[model samples]
Target: MTAALFLTSCSRKIIPGKPVLSSTRFTTDSLPLSEIDVPLRINLKPLYETANKNVQTIYGSPGWPNDFEVVNCDTRYMYRFKRGPLMITAHANTVNFNFTGSYIIAGAQRICTGTGSNRIPITPWTPTCTCGLNEGERRVNIGFKALLTLKDNYDVSAKLQRLEPRPLDKCTVCFWRQDITSTVMDQLKVQLDDTGNEISDSLNRLNLRSPFQQLWDMLNTSIPMFGMGYLQINPEKLRLSTLYAQNDTLNISVGISARPRISLTKTVGYRTVVPDISDFNQRKGFSIFVDAVMDYDSLSQLLTRELYHKRVDMDKTGKYIIIERCEIYGAGNEKLIIKIEFSGPDKGTMYLTGRPYFNRGKNQVEIKDIDYDIHTRDLLIKTAKWLFNRRIINTLNHYSTFNIAAYADTLLSKVNVQLNRQWQKSVSTAGAVNNLQVMAIYPLTENLVLRCNIRGELTVRIDAFDF
Candidate 1:
C-alpha cells in the first residue's frame, strides 16, 4: 500500500531548475561590550611580615640626654622599652596593629636650688629605679591604625590614624604614687613617627603592574576548542571595584570589557597595553556574548547522515519517495536551503528553504516555514502532485532541528579551561561557567553562526606581591 505501488504509468523525469536565491551578505550586528568580572583575593600576610621586619622593636635606651628626661625638682628618668611582635588586623579599608612589650625605668627625685636664670642641682644624681637592675619590667601596650587607599596609577597610600601607648604599671617616687607613662610615651613619639613613615613608604612602593599586565596579555591570547575552532576573548577596557579586607586578605573585583567570538581558524588580534585603573563599580558575575560560527560542510554531513535513504510514504497512496541525499547551505535573506534528492515515482532533486530559530524550551535550533523552491513547486504540481503533501513538510520540520545543548557544553568546557589556570608565576585564576544559551542563529554563506550568551564567575589570586 505504498505510493510507488499504485503508479500505473511511468512519470516523465522532473528536473526543476535550482532556486536562485538573491545574494545577501550576513553581517553581525554591533552589540554592546560584554563585561567579564573576576574577583581578586590578595594575601596580606607577606606585607605584615615585611612591616614587622622593618619596624624597630626597641625604642629608648637607658642612657641620658638622648633617651632620658629631667624635670627640675620633679623627677629625672632614663628608660629602655622593647616591643613584642606586631599583631595586625584589617576591616573595611583600615589596618590595625597592636604591640605589647615591657619597659624599665630608672630615675630619682631631683631638687633644684636658685633662681630660674641660675638653677643648680644640689645633690649628686644617685637614683633609685623601678623595673631595672635585675628587676622585672613594666608591661605596656602600643596601638596604631592605618587607613589605606588606592590610586589610579596602582599606588597604595597608607595614612597613619594615630599612635597610642598605655603603661600597665605606675611608678611611686618619694613615698608618693606617680604616673610617668605620659613622659615615656612623649619621649617615644619621634621613634614611632619614623616607624610609621617607613611602613607607609614601603606600602607606597608596592607595584601591581607586572601581575595585571600578565593577566591582560593572557586574556588577549587565543584559546583552541577541541574539534571546533579557536576562541578569542578580545578584552578591552578594565575596571576595579571597591576594596574590602577580610582577616589577612584583601578582596576586590576586577572587570573587563570583552567581545568574544569563535572562528574556524586561529586568529591573532592586536594587543593593547594595560591602562590605568578606572573608577570603582559594584557588580558581580560575568556576562559575555559569543558569536559561535560553524562550517556549512560539517552541518551538511550531520544532516545527511540522518536523512539519507530515509523512506517517506506520502499519504500511503503508493506515491512515495526514498531520500537519496541532502545538503544544507545558506539561501540568502537569512534563510537556510536544504537540497534533497530522491527517487520513486519521479527521479529529481528539490530544495526546501526555511528560517532557522532557536527553541529555548528544547534548547535546539529548529527550522520553521519550510517550503519547496519556486521551480520545484511548479514541476511537482504538474508531474508529481503527491509530493505537495503537508506530511513531507512536517517530516522535514521534525528532523531539521539541531540540538544545541551538546555544542554548548563543549564550548563551556573550552572556556572554563582558559578561565581557570595560572597565567603568571604569582597570579592564577579560577572560574566556572554556569550557563551558555543560544540567543539567535544566522545562516551565512560559509558558516552557520550562533549568537550565544554565557554567564560565569571568575576569581584571580596573587599569592605573593612585593611589599
Candidate 2:
C-alpha cells in the first residue's frame, strides 16, 4: 500500500516537461531499497540429508534415560489367581514406541460440541510467533477406532519400540475407556513413577517452579476419571497450559509460565566419570525416580511378582525384554540384547568420560578393571566400620591419649580409612556445617502420586532415502 501511494503521488505530480521512459524503470523509483543478487552455492544432497537426519532424530526415537538400581531380583506370586490375570498383553496388541502398564490409550477424539468425520482445522492466526526463516516443525494426525477385550489367557510376547517423550506440544495420552468396570478401573488409576523428583528437580533447576506448582495444583484440584478424568499436559517454550480434571474445557485452562532455552556441554575423565558437574549450558534437571520405597524389602517383593508375571508373559512373544538387573552381556545378538529397563517422557543421560581403567604403574598397560568381588569386598569393609561408628569414633578419641598403636589397630586393620592429621590446625579453615539446615525432607506420599509409565523402542537403521 505504501508503494502504491508513492507511485500514485508521483503520477499525480508528473512534471510538464518530464516523460516516463519505461514502466520497469518507473516502478524502480518507488522501490524500498537497492537489491543485491549474490551468487549461491548449495549442495542439495547434503542439505536434504541434514534435513532428513534431523527429522528422524525428532520422530524416529524419543524417551527418557534408563537407570537400573543394582540389586538382585527374583519373581514371586502376587495373588496366584487359579490362572494368571486375564488382560490384553501389549505383546499381542501395541503401537510403535508404546509401553505396557494398563494403558487407557487415547486417540484423536475430534473435540467439539458438534462433530463428524467432516471436521475443520482450527489454526488461528496467532498474534506473534518468534519463528525464524529455517524453523522446522511437523504435526502428525494418528488415530483409529477399535474394541479390545481381555481373554482368559492374555499370554503373548511382543516388541515395544520406545519413542521420545514430548509433553508440551503434542498430547499423547492414555485415557480410560468409558465402559470399564469399577474393579478394572483401579488399574487405570495406578500411575507410573515417571520419577517426579527427577521431573520436579529438573523443573526447579530449570527455574520452572511457578509453572510446576501450577501444574501440581491443577492435577490435584480433582481426580480425573472420577467421572472422565482428563490429564492434559502441555510442555512448550514461553508458556504451558494443563488441565487435570477440572471444569468443562472452556473454564479449565492453564497458562504456561514463560521459559528459556536449554543447552549443555560436558567433560568426562577417569577419577570421576563426570569430571565437571557443570550445568549443561541448557536447563539441567533429571527425572529422579522419587517414588520413595520405604520398606525396600517389601516393595521389592511386590515389584518382583509384578515384573515376573509381566516378563514371563512377555517372553512368550519372543521379544527380548529389558527389565531391572536383567544382567544382559556378551553383545551382538539382537534377541538377547537389551540395555535399559524403564524410562520417562523426557529422561536425561549424563555421559561421563574415562572409565575404571587400570594403570599399570606409568607405562606397562594392558590391564582389566577390578573384579566385582574385590569392589564388593572394599565396600563391605568400609560399610562394617560405618555400621559401627561409635567404636570407631571412640578409638579415634582415645588417640588423644597418644596411643598410636590402639588407633591403628582399631581402624587400619579392618578398614582402609585414609587419614591426614595436620601438624597444626586452623579452626576457621573449613566451611560451616549445616546438617539441620540441609534437610533431606521427603514429601508425604499423599501429595505425590506414583505413576508407572513404561517405554518401548525398536532400533532400526536408515536403510533407504527418497527425495
Candidate 3:
C-alpha cells in the first residue's frame, strides 16, 4: 500500500535528555532551498558543431564570393580572380578559463569582396568594358571574446567585448602591376571587422532555454526510486544564479524551489504549485523535513510475530506468562498506546504509554518514558499481582524500547543503500544523509507520525545528460 510522506533537517549531535510528555501539536513549516554549492558543467563540443554546420550551409552557395579583389587608384579599376571558399573554425578550451573569466576565439579565412573593371578598350573610340571580380584571398586571423550573462528575463546572452587582429597566413597571388598593396591590405582589414561583427551577433543568440526546459519537465516527474518509493520534487518555479566560465566549461548554479512529495505508489499524478515563485529563497546547501507515517496495523503484525506465543516465567511455581497478541494506536497527545493481551492465570489485557525519540548515534527511533497506563497499573497491583507479576511490566518496556528503533533503522538503511549506489554510477545524481534526527512524534487519527530533520549534500553530474 502507498503511504503519505513529508520532508525536514537533521541534528549534528544527539541530545542527552529524558523524553517529556506534552499535549502540544506539530505541523510542517515551509522550508527554503539549502545554501549548498552545486557545480554544473556544460560541454561546448555540440555548440561548436552546430555553429560550423550553420556557417557552411549559409555561405556555401553557387552565387557567393570565393575569392578576393584588388583595385587600381589611377584608373579606378578593379581586378578579381578565383581563390578559395570562405571558412570558419571554432576551438573550445574548458581547462584554461577561471570561474568568472571569458575568452573564446573563432577564426575566419578567405573573406573579401570588391568591384572590378578592364582599362583596355576594344577600339580607340570605345569605352573600356567593366566587370566585378574578386581574387588573391587568404586567411586573416582574428580573436573574439564574449561574456555570458544571465538576464532577469530567464535567458542567456553572449556579449562580445573584444576583437584582436592577428597576422594573416601567406597567400599566392598574381599582381596587377600597380602600387595597390596598401589599398588591398586596408580592404582586407575592413572585411575582418565586418565578419567578426556577424559572428558575435550569431553567438549572442545562443541561450539554454530549450535544454533547461526539458530538464525542468523531467524533474517535475518521478525521480529515481529509493527502495519501493520514489521522490517527486514539485517545483513552484526555477531560479538561476552564479553563471560563469570555469576551466573551459560553463558552470551554472540552479536553485530549485519545490514543495516535494514522496510516495510508494506509481499512480500519483503531477503536483501543482500553490505558492508564488517570489516566495522562494535563493540560497545554497540542502535541508528537508519528512513526515513518515507508521500504520498501526503493520506495527501490530510485526510485534505479534516477534513476541506472540513466547512465554516469560516469573516464578518456578508454573506461574509463566504467554503473550496472545499485541495492538498499537495513538493516544492523541504525542503518546503511543500499546495494548498487550496475555494468556495466563491473570488472562487479561494490559496497556502502556510512551514518547518517541530518535537516537542519532544508534540510528534508531526508541520509545522513551515508557510506563504502565495509570488505570492498568492499579488493577495489576491490586488484583493480578500473583499471575501477572511485576516482571511482566519490565518485559513489556524492553520490547517497546527496541522494536521501534529496529524499524526506523531498517527504513533508513534502505534509503541510504539506494542513494550510495547511485553515487557510484558515472552519470547519476546522489544524496548523502547526515545528522538525521527525529524532530517530533505525534499520533494521528489513522497513523502514528514521526517528523524528522535531515541535512546532507546532493551531487549531480552534468556529463552524459545526467540531471
**TM-scores, all models, native as reference:** 0.70, 0.12, 0.63
Q: Relative to the unseen true structure, what is the C-alpha lDDT of residue 160 in candidate 2, on a scale of 0 to 100?
A: 22
Note each model's CA RMSD in angstroms.
Answer: 7.1, 42.2, 11.6
lDDT: the better of candidates 1 and 2? 1
**CA lDDT, every prediction?**
0.76, 0.20, 0.49
Model 2 superposed RMSD (Cα)? 42.2
Candidate 1: residue 420 lDDT (0-100): 82
Query: lDDT (0-100) at residue 291 of candidate 1?
Result: 85
**Candidate 3 ranges beyond 4 A from true positions:** 1-36, 56-137, 165-167, 170-202, 209-239, 257-285, 313-321, 341-351, 359-363, 369-390, 403-427, 464-467
User: Which residue pairs come into collision in candidate 1?
Assistant: 2-318, 3-318, 3-319, 4-318
State the displacement of the C-alpha of residue 64, model 3, in Å, after optimal TM-score superposition. Answer: 5.0
* Best candidate (score: lDDT): 1
lDDT per residue (tens digit) for residues 1-467 in model 1: 11111234575455677777777766667755889888888888888898888878777754642555766545577677777998999998888988887776667665668876577878766556554345467677778888887777777778875467777765444312566567666766666676667767766676666567767877787777675688888887888777788779888788888888887778786577888887678677899898888777777787778888888888877778888888888855688888888887667677788888889998998888999877778777766788877877887888888897887787788778867887677778888998987877888777788888889899989877664
Cα TM-score of candidate 3 = 0.63
lDDT of 2 by residue, 1-467 (tens): 01111123212211111111122211101111111111111112321233223321211101111221111121111110011111111111231221222211112222223245444444322222111112322122111111122111211122222222222122122222243223222211222112212222221222223222333332222212222112221222212121111111111111222111111111121111111111112221111111111222332343333343222112232322222321112111111111112212111111101111112232111112211222222332343212112331232122211112332233222211111111112100111111111102111211111211111111111112222
Local distance difference test, candidate 1 = 0.76
